[model samples]
Target: MNFSVGPPGLIIAAPRSGAGKTTVTLGLLRALRRQGGAVQPFKCGPDYIDPAFHEIAAGRPSFNLDSWAMGEELIATLATEASAGATISIAEGVMGLFDGAAARGRSGTGATADLAALLGWPVVLVLDVAGQTETAAAVALGCARYRDDVDIAGVILNRVASQRHFSLVAPAFDRINMRIFGAILREDRLALPERHLGLVQAGEIPAIDQRLDALADIIAAAIDLDAIGQSARPAKAAIAIREAHSDGARSRLQPPGQRIALAQDRAFSFMYPHVLRQWRHAGAEIVPFSPLADDPPDATADAVWLPGGYPELHAGALASAHSFREGLQKLARRSIPIHGECGGHMVLGRGLEDADGNRHEMTGLLGLETSFAKRRLHLGYRRARLRIACALGAKGTEVLGHEFHYASTVSTSDDPLVDCWDAAGAEVPEQGARQGSTTGTFFHVIDRIAI
Candidate 1:
């Protein structure tokens, strides 16, 4: 469906990571929603985590707009689609506004600035002004003048000390003509606890609504809500996607099976929104089952999809889950194609060692050994060429994805499932494993290299 009206949209970005962009973005989403405004939230880049929080805050599903993994047209189309009926769309920027995958040979390949420039969205910059006085204003000035394409509409000073601190930074920003929307005082409660994969999943966090409401109250008291609303410039008119215009080898996104039984529990929640959406768009029925509740895949389904999530955290429960294990094994014996990624990949292995160094028995479908106890952070943007005709793609089909996990592979005796590389196309040795009808990889697919 086309957006009859081009909705007002803005990008909430920061000078760097740990600069309170997520907190401010969540706060603003809740605050705006409370004021009877329909808010659409989006996270830039190939992140599965932040969008979950965005959804919880805005009471609507959030989508990703990746400048690296996704094509420019897809990004624009997704942006328009995600905000169809919303009053305003707020996109939380990835990393620094201008910092993209510089090694990828494209300006703004993974950056928020690229997405902002593409959609002509004004940027509401969040500056974590903890210790700095006038220097914080200097940073904002530099960012505003850095790129002409990205319009830095306003600045929200986060973690300010007091009236004296705000006074010191306020004059400098005013002098440079950089609009300061609000100043948030230093508050420890505004921060969220994080794991190796960024903040713990929104579902796992207890009292999540209360936490978001507290953050919203903080923003409502400090920030200029009307100013932020007014700053969201309308996005460009929606354009017809290339897939619609041409009949070339476009991404039809066939579902792995006609009746796809998706493992959609707390343990397997990292499914990409676009692919699931595309599968439905292509006439596939998605049957969801909860592995965390010790439930099996819908027995009538043809294929099984165990997406990536925090399986390591619940390894004990999974190791003892007879219904899920026995049911999945029955499917595997019937030659049903089952695929896993990251955490799901770990669950598919022979065993997984938790952070406490306790080994838990996993489904022995693939000859792989994984351990989170001996954690090794493997984080990167990946480009994969499938070595076999596996669940991911056909032989030699290339896909753009990312690997972000704290689990280390202890052993992988089976043949490599995918010949993988970092975003720059340099070879990454022995990236994944495959057996009979089972395939597992640490890399989470964003899209099949946006042909």
Candidate 2:
């Protein structure tokens, strides 16, 4: 059976990080939703936060489309699945349009440009014209001319000082025949709060719906919604590839268990939507429990998964959760499969030292000890080959994932879980640990090798 291309979409990108891509993307999503359009939102990399905010604005779940960690078939399949029955899809780009991993990936550089070129979608460049005026056009022109495959459809002048500022920038784009879709004046209230990782997760914000409504009001008044709608194009190339390789394209990461107990809350909220979606699609059940609420994993669960999040912020409370701690121990004794990633890995350790240098007792399922007191950034894409049989896969199974955390491991005595390498194919120290039924790593798995 052949699968057709899904809805038309546009990629929201910028010249660099913090160039107002999120703001423009969120505003456009809410604006289009308010106009009665069914908008599907997606993120271009291994991000968990922006997609949450995108969900709120679009009233739909957002999926990550990582060109580096995921294969072309998986990326295209995810985009096609998520865009079904939507009027348009809006993918928020990661960093700059061309910035990506240090080395080339299975696709390209894992850049927003790669996704754009792969899907045949047009890019709406968001230019932060705060410091300069006409020079912004030069930047857009550089991005547009940077690659022959990636199409820069139009430009959005963000953080403009005033009508005068926009007037100066508008003429430059017109001279170069570049479309100026919109000009949003500088508004401090429009900015989202940020922490060490990225924007504070969307759920933490109070009255977030009101904030999105206000954003939609501003964007609908400024941006040309009609023009943007007209510029979108379906993922024709991606759909064709999927159709030609229909049999092999159906592959997805195997679910950890039949009844997976997933830890979820503000402290452990970084689980990938696509992962869970695939699990459900495969007929696996997700039983969610909140460690922040001191809730234990369901007794009927055959396996437990602890996703990464901001456990450091709530280390004190977690230390006092007797029930959650006891439940994990019981599950491990039952020989049930258990896995953790990043913050979850930290929580499974014997102890965790918060930023204040206060040590808190954890589940102690593994011998690992972690510390946020002397925080060190561990951020990169990883190629992991499991050393022992676990929920992730059989021993020696390779998986693609990423490690993004600031916690340092003070100690660990358990056997290593995976032999790891960086995106550049250089060998890194072995990562993760396994003891009996429990296994964990700072790495968050994205997809398994296709065998």
Candidate 3:
């Protein structure tokens, strides 16, 4: 029932991708934090990477605000909950404002614009003014006129060449009447590295604080933080927020003590925080253990969970983690339910080959071999139907989740992790995989649905 009432605001974004949305967002977050602002940052959509930088900037755990996956009530609830103790909130938008759950001709629904319209937040367009000058104004103008739903507050020009470039671009915005927020200097320090999953899981980045601080300073010098803070409007009436435990009514019949040991480390970090919270609310005590730390679960837990992350990066360490491997084996021998997600799915395989084509041993629970050698990116918003019993549910259970990874399984058998479908209703081969009481897959279960 906790509520947040303060100088909360949002960042409406994206004229396009690679337009420096992430950099600008990170810079603003860091700069605001540096200025002694309790900035609660939220990433629109189901992205895990951007939230990492948000956390770094806000000095708090950043949460995802997916308009597509979650209902409006949930969005308001999450935003209000996250904003409780902060001076202001910054919601970094995803993709282009209009770009949504799917490409132009698709059926999926989540998008930056969709979120903006739902939350009633102002848009601060981060336009890439690299090649075009006044035409960039036309682009911004078109975005403004394209949808009456978005409130295009201002513009931030990225990759500016010189004062000369702004000299030209600023005039164009003047012609279109879009206020120019600020221009980020085209510096290498402001950029973060990217890979198949997104910006190399923030944990993988060395000297993360220094990187964040540098980006913050760069942005602070450019942006007027006061104006940005002023851009935040008062949230809707207090009744708008849903309770954190609002979804508990659906799980009144589930039993308690079905304990689960979750894998948490650089290799298995794709878990949704809300999901864990809801599981606990639903009578499951989730025990967290680390594969990277070479630790095993205490023998008392009834189930094991390995969420997704960069297992490919630490295949060597994970393969050599005798305590964890033996512990999983022992737990499986005792008929304890074991489940794995993307990176977890890979870890349960017989072997895992890194990006370099070198193979390493894994837990071998699923008798599958996975590799990033071929590196076919399987990214999508997935909907799955359980065809058989597993740790979280039984056959015929439907769940909404996401798939984001670059590794693929080299399977000799047709046994899949789970029987599922995508948002498009196409049969997804392995919603997840199972061996005895152990199961793993690339699906990211949405916490809201379970709640």
Give the per-residue lDDT digits (tens) of candidate 3, residues 1-451.
5444344577659777789888888888888888887888888777888887778777877777665555555566567765778887888888888876543212126677776666667889998888888888998999888879778888888889898888987887887778888887689877788987788778779999898888888898888888888888655555265454565335222322378788888888887765665567667887889989999986899888888888888999999999999999999999888888788878987899998999999988888788889978787776666667676575665566678887777763425545666655677665467788887768776632442
Backbone clashes under 3 angstroms, per model: 0, 0, 4
Cα lDDT computed for each candidate against the true fold: 0.84, 0.89, 0.75
User: What does candidate 1's lDDT look like per residue over 1-451, in tens digits?
Assistant: 3433257899999999989999999999999999999999989887888999999999998888787887655666677765788999999998888888747422247888888887889999999999898998889889988989889998999999999989988999878888999999999899888887888889989999999999999999999999999999877665434445443225434577889889898889998887787678767799999888999888888888899999988899999888998889999988888889888888988999998999999988888888888767788888888887777777777777788888888887777788787867678864687888888889888777423
Of 1 and 2, the candidate ranking higher by TM-score: 2
What are the per-residue Cα lDDT tens digits for candidate 2 across 1-451?
Answer: 4456789988999999988899888999999998899999999999999999999999999999998888877788777876788999999999999999999877666799999988889999999899897899899999999999999999988899988877777888989899989889899879888999999999999899999999888888889999999999988653454443454444467888999999999999998999998899789999999998999999999999999999999999999999998999999999999999999988998999999999999999999999989978888899999888898988888888888888888999988899999999998764799999999989899987765
Backbone clash pairs in model 3 (N, Cα, C under 3 Å; residues 3+ apart or in different chains), count = 4
Clashing pairs in 2: none
Q: Best candidate per lDDT, number? A: 2
Task: Give TM per candidate.
Answer: 0.95, 0.97, 0.90
Comparing 1 and 3 on lDDT, the stronger one: 1
Model 3 lDDT at residue 7: 49
Residue 380's lDDT within candidate 1 is 82
